[model samples]
Structures are given as C-alpha cells and as structure tokens.
Target: MKILFVCLGNICRSPVLEAVLRAHAEKAGLDWEIASCGTGDWHLGHGADPRSRASAQRRGYSLAAHRARQLCAADFRRYDWLLAADRSNLAEIVRRRPADATARVALALAHAGLPQPLDVPDPYYGNAEGFEAVVDLAEAIARAIVARDAE
Candidate 1:
C-alpha cells in the first residue's frame, strides 16, 4: 500500500507523520510505502521546521531527511491514499484532484479515528510545546494506521 501524508507546508505535521507511519509500518512488517507533501509550495525543498525535528527526535523518529514538496496531480495517481492533516488541507487536495484520478483522500487523523476535522495547527509560529503536541497527535494517528493495516 502506498500512503501520502499532506499538510499546508509539509515542514512540520506531514513530515512527522511520514516518519512515524513509515517506522510503524516497517516494524509491523507491512509492505507500505509512505511519503509526505504540502498543499502549498511555500516551503518546497526545505527541511522540516527545527522544533518539529527536535520534537520527533525526542521520540526516536527522525525528520532530518524530509524535504517539503507541493502536492501534485501525480500524487493522486501514485498513492493509494492521500491523508490530509486537517480539513483545509483536505479540501485543498480535493480541489486539485484530476477528473480521472481515483486515489482516496481523507483527513489523516480521521483515518486514525480522530474525531476532529480541523487541520493540525501549524507549530511554526508557536513554541516548542506546540511542536510537541503536533508530534503527539501524529504518533497517535500513525499507531492507529499501523493497527488498521495489521487488520
């Protein structure tokens, strides 16, 4: 299975999720391919935010190699699933969908059973605690994906 995680800028939440889910899938022995992208092009090719990288490292998930990229039409055809970080991102991705694309798109948290529809708040403008919270939420959702894939 191929899964793509999406967020606004791809520097914080999405990259963290990509690492977390990839690690879990590997440990579970699942043949899953994971990648992350952003709805916006502002941070393309940039590494994840420093705070986000630090927070993920604290939990043993490395975001060092992740580079932000914008979501493209090819993504819809390449991935089996496109998981958005929040509703806004979700909507943005949906708006970009090609008429012939068949990939399934949904909120990443919701796919993980999170009840909220809002996007994971951006931690860029916030403090370390905010980045930690983003990690916490991403970890929870990644575990949930692992569990679902196991079943």
Candidate 2:
C-alpha cells in the first residue's frame, strides 16, 4: 500500500503525518510505502519546519531528513491513497486530482472512527504546544490506520 499525506504546505502537518505513519507501519511489519507533499509550492525541496522537527523529535519521531514537495497530478496515479490533513486541502486535492487517477482521496482522520472528520491544524505560527498537539493527533491517526489495515 502506498499512502501520500497532503497539507497546504509540506513543512508542518503533512510531513509530521508522513513520519508518524511510516513509523507505525514499520513497527507493525507492514510493507506500506508512505510519503508527504503540499498543495502549495512554497516550501518545495525544503526540510520540515524547525518547530515541527523539534516537536516530532520530542515524541521519538524524526523529521530530520524530511523535505517538502508540492503535490502533482502524477501523485494521484502513484499512490494508493491520498490523505489530506484538513478539509480545505482535501477539497483542493479532489479538485486537482486527475480524472483517470486511481488514488482514493480523503481526510486522514476519516478512518479514525470519529463521528466527523477532524482537520489536523496547521501549527506553523504557534509555539511548541501546537506542534505537540499535532503529534498527539498524528499518533492517533497512525494507530487508526494500522488497526484498520490489520483488520
């Protein structure tokens, strides 16, 4: 299974989700391929935000080598799933997805069993606490994905 996580910018939410989900999949012995990208091109080729990297490190996940990339039409054909961090990103992804693409696109939290999907908030302008919150959400989402796949 190949999964691609998306957000407005690759520097924060999407990259964090990529790292968290990859860790969970690896620990579960799943052979899933995971990656992340942003709808915008602003941070392309740049590493994740400093605060995001620091917050992830505190939770034992590394964002040390994560580089931001912009989402492209080809990604829809490459990944099995495209998981958006928030509703806005999800909408944009759907709008931009190729007509013949085979990827399933949805909010990352959709399978978490929540009554309603929750958007993974952008923490770029906030302090460490915001990033910490993102970690909490990312862990939950990762576990949910792993559990669902196991079933």
Candidate 3:
C-alpha cells in the first residue's frame, strides 16, 4: 500500500507523520510505501523545523532527512491513501484531485478515531510543547493506520 501524509507547510506535521508511520509500518512487517507533502509550496526543499525535529527525536522518530514539497496532481495517481493533517489540508488536496484517481483522501486523525476531526494545529509559530503535541497526534494516527493495514 502507498500512503502520503500531507500538511500545510510539510516542515512540521506531515514530515513527522511520515516518519512515525514509516516506523510503525516497518515494525508491523507491512510492505507499505510512505511519503509526505504540503498543500503549499512555501517550504519546498526545506528541512523540517528544528523544534519539530527535536520533538520527534524525543519520541524516537527521525525527521532529519525530510524535505518539504508541495502536493501535485500526480500524487493522486501515485498513492493509495492520501492522509491530511487537518480539514484545510484535506480540502486543498481534494480540490486538486483527479476524477479518475483511486486514491482515498481523508484526515489522519479521523482514521485514528479522533473525537474531533479538527486541524492538526501548526507548530511553526508555536513553542516546543506545541511540537510535542503534534508528534503525539501523529504517532496515534500512525499506529491506527498500521493496525488497519494489518487487517
């Protein structure tokens, strides 16, 4: 299965989600392809934010090699699942979706059975704690996806 995680900037939430999901999938012995992107191209080619990376590192996940990139039309055709961090990101991705693509797009948090499918708050303008929260949410959702893939 191919999964793509997406966020607003790709430097914080999406990259972290990609790393977490990759680790979980590997541990579960699932043959899955995982990647991430952003709805906007503002941070294209940039490494994840320092705080975001630090937060993920604390949780035993690495975002060091992740570079920001924008969601593209081909992505809809390339991935089996398109997991967005929030509603806005989901909306942006849906707006660009190709009619014939078979990819299933939805919020990652919702896949995890989150009570509220709200936006995964952007940590770019926040502090370390904010980044940590993002990591926590990402980890939860990643695990959920891994579990579902197992079945």
Number of the candidate with higher TM-score, 1 or 3: 1
* lDDT ranking, high to low: 2, 1, 3
- Please give the distance, in angstroms, between residue 119's alpha carbon in candidate 2 and its true position after superposition: 0.4
Global lDDT scores for all candidate models: 0.90, 0.91, 0.88
Candidate 1: residue 88 lDDT (0-100): 88
| Tens-place lDDT digits, model 3, residues 36-69 | 9998989999999999889999999998898899
After superposition, which runs of candidate 1 have C-alpha atoms over 4 Å from their true positions?
Answer: none
lDDT (tens digit, per residue) of candidate 2 on 1-151: 9999999989999999999999999999999999999999998899999999999999899999999999999999999999999999999999998889999998888855543538988888888898998898999999988988966
lDDT of 3 at 35: 98
Q: Using alpha carbons, what is the TM-score of model 1?
A: 0.96
Q: Once model 1 is optimally superposed onto the true structure by TM-score, how far is the C-alpha of residue 47 displaced, in angstroms?
A: 0.8
lDDT per residue as tens, model 1, 1-151: 9999999999999999899899889999998999999999999899999888999999999988889999999999999999998888998988999998878998898888877645677788889998998888887888888897789
Q: RMSD, model 1, all Cα superposed?
A: 1.1
Task: Give me the overall lDDT of model 1.
Answer: 0.90
Order of candidate numbers by TM-score, starting with the best: 2, 1, 3
